[model samples]
Target: MTRETPAGDLTLANLTKTFGRRTAVDDLSLTIPQSSFFALLGASGCGKTTTLRMIAGLETPTSGQVLLGDRDIARLRPYRRPVNTVFQSYALFPHLDVFENVAFGLRRRGIRSVGGQVRQMLSLVQLDGYERRRPAQLSGGEQQRVALARALINHPQVLLLDEPLGALDLTLRRQMQVELKRLQAEVGITFVHVTHDQEEAMTMADTVAVMNAGRIEQLGAPADIYEFPATAFVARFLGQSNLIAGDVTGGSGDDLLVTAQGARFSVPAGRSRTDRGPVFLGVRPEKLHLATAALRVPAGHQHLDGTITDASYLGVSTQYLLRTAGGVELSVFVANSGDQQRFAIGERAVAYWNPRHAFLLGRRAETPDPTAPVAGEPVGVSA
Candidate 1:
């Protein structure tokens, strides 16, 4: 939905929310570019919904500021703000038909000739002929469309969606994913969608903000966020990973030696702050390859000898549990091409990966403060 405002950007400066002494949202700040499909992704209690409510003027922040373009909207009433929300439940009026639901907002604004606007909105959501159908007569998907039409009819500047598709079945969920993407392209309005589903965020968002403990752990394009996760939490949360804990032994420009399980492996350098301390090496299962006798190890490939402790064959790919000689357990995935190479359990194999595939994380050691008390001494140290 579009609104006329001199302020053209959405900004949250030092935003926070608290209930009693429990801080629901910390000092979080973010800027949503105009017309961007931004997603706020996090688990429950991570302050995602609370943040959205603050932006919608449904919840007031304990501290910080909410700016829409140049206007401060933190204190504005929900109706006064140029935004609308599509709740997960659709929240359609059971008694009203699709046309009436869509026209509800327009009617509130004292617009009497709502027939044309209602028709156009319904058509935009692909619900052209269902205007006469009541909510009880429509399917789940149809009801969702009516809710969307209702929100969009108002022409809001920013549309907030809170798990709008959470009620649909798996197949319908996927279908709606495609439909929602297409609709976003057609409307070209700024969408701030909130969901705990990582796949949904990856599929729909132009940019994703990963939130944890009331703070944004990472924010970037979907591909970039998936490929180059900034923290250990992100690496583990975003996807399945084999995290090999180790210490840095040697290094030379963009490459480093990591000693783990009594073996020194050459891993990419300058990727982590823990160049000398204990570090966690992360590798996605798909990145690991099962080295065969006929298969040649590519240049810069980091090879590790392991035994296939377990194996499972899915239609698309084969999963292998490789237990390395150094006692490091790795999950490897091999694509099931036309001719799948089946590796029997307990078979010896070499699991290899490119140096660039590994993600080095965490510091090796904590730098002690000189002014701090010694292990067996009091805080007020006496010479």
Candidate 2:
């Protein structure tokens, strides 16, 4: 595959889409850097897929511009746009073998001599030896690669992946995540992936945009967004967060003092979303350490006195639910390092963490409480 113009940033300016009275994508705008792996991450119906469709020309934007470099292609037909989409279904022709499936794009353009290109594409996807195998004979992962090879053969400036790994099982999904990232780096083309899986977006994307209710709630590198979420929804949706409702009391040096659930804590001024009024003190479960009477709280660490309400030993770590005196519940994760102490249910304990590990968010959003247990345990609390 070859391109006359070098791949540049793919920009969407105030893009939107609607279905009758409901807005699917609401004034979405973002720039995907050249050769970057970008992910639109959100739960189903958050408009991630709709945003990708708009970029691929599968859905017309109600208002906005789709710019590849400086060229606007918002109104272009799907086939005319310099973009290709790989859907979750793979969409490979059942009767076509791997070779024909990958070469389908090139052959459609009336390229008579496609043997070399077909073989090269197959090799690029590590399917060179399986060209003769039909879609029915290949594994789920194999068919996905075939679809990728087919799309890449067109040399599109942008590749849209709509839950492309949704069909694979857990193991295969993780494997494909690595392969997709590697392929994006090797091809040097903007790859826009859409998925609801937090781990998938974090593992494969250079940047992740968390969407909610038809708009992007937050966008940044995985670690940045994970460590410092811009919104309460982003904090809970991206991963499990222990959010303690609090009121900013005052400022002390570089930390803002917060009072929550009869406990006073310090949040880094730079990390606090707001320095005054009602706020939520947020911290990752893994960042909090549990200490019993035998263990002492580290100096300068914020501590919350609570009773262990639940404890589950999950091989590599232990998940504990602690309920504070003021009825505020928190989750703590302690890594199992052989001789680590284990606390029993009903045991008095204290959860402590460094002030720098805490972040502040404006009053909670209308999303479901993340610490609420799903089934018998909190989501992502286990190994």
Candidate 3:
């Protein structure tokens, strides 16, 4: 669902979190637009949950700003903020029925005449008929819906979901992905969801923020983030990628030549400058193809000769692991469209891709230890 008008805006400025000697979040900043389904995506312990909790006022930042709309909510309590969370465990009362569970928050706030509102919330979540059932009687998906209803009943400006669908089975999880997207559209509220599942984030989020080591590595639309990852970590973490490390050697207009592993290849300049040495080349598995005899390698085209080491058939496509002459392993995914060309384990093939399909990544720097001396102070440098 698309919104005609802008919703609320959330901004984090230099947000930092520390637990004694270790830093959980490090000077992170992000802007979440109003009415957007934004996802915080990363691996476990990447500080996604810590960032979300800070935003929800459940955990205060060591130093930073959390702005919701025009208000600075750094000092606000959890219950005072116009935001609610749908916890992963649902946190529903096993003794209470679905109706009462959904109405718990309102009842605590001394909201009378909540019967109509409770029924309306239940209907919105498609759980009107199950209002009498307790959490024990509800399935995983049903309990999730109840939790969502409970959160939405408060009509908060923003809803924070911390892996709300992580506990469901595969089929039900996929189903809930679609249903949750529809529900977000219907209610037209801003949603800030945190999950480690890349596919789920890509499917449900309008904007994805890739977090790493307590910092946001990149934030953009799902397609943009996938097609043009900002860092090597984002490229390798979001999906299957073949990373080839190289050094820039030549430049031609918007293209660059890189030499690596005894081979030279041309790739787009991308966002990096020519002077950035020791760059990494990234290409998705699906973008690679097996070079056919008829599909001659055009002039300046990048190609590698390799032998198939492994193959796996996945209905729509076949995945192949090819080891090049230089002993570099490359993962190639080819579509199984009509008359599948089966390759033996030892068959020789050429894996090739276009220059524009390759991306250049900046090299990462070493992180300073928490107990280390401050910069400019006398400290021993690693040899």
Best by TM-score: 2
Q: Count the backbone clashes (under 3 Å) in each candidate.
A: 8, 0, 0
Better of 1 and 3 by lDDT: 3
lDDT per residue for candidate 3 within 160-179, as digits (tens), equals 99998999998999999999
Per-model TM-score versus the true fold: 0.89, 0.94, 0.90
Q: Candidate 1 vs candidate 2: which has greater lDDT?
A: 2
**Deviation in Å, model 2, residue 303 alpha carbon:** 1.2
Candidate 1 has an lDDT of 0.82
The 10-residue segment of model 1 with minimum total lDDT is 364-373
Clashes, model 1: 8
Weakest ten-residue segment in model 3 by summed lDDT: 364-373
Global CA lDDT of candidate 3, please? 0.83
Which regions of candidate 3 are displaced past 4 Å?
A: 1-7, 271-276, 292-295, 298-300, 364-383
Q: How do the candidates rank by lDDT, highest first?
A: 2, 3, 1
lDDT (10s digit) by residue, model 2, range 1-383:
45436557899899988899999988888898888899999999999988888888878899999999898999999999989999999999999888889889888999989989888888889986998898999999999999999999988889999999999999999999999998888888889999999999999999999999899899899999999999878988888788888789999999899988877788989998888988889989999999895577889888888889888787888988898887767878899998888899899999999888999998844544444556865444521
Give candidate 2 regions above 4 Å deviation. Answer: 1-4, 364-383
Residue 217 of model 3: what lDDT? 89
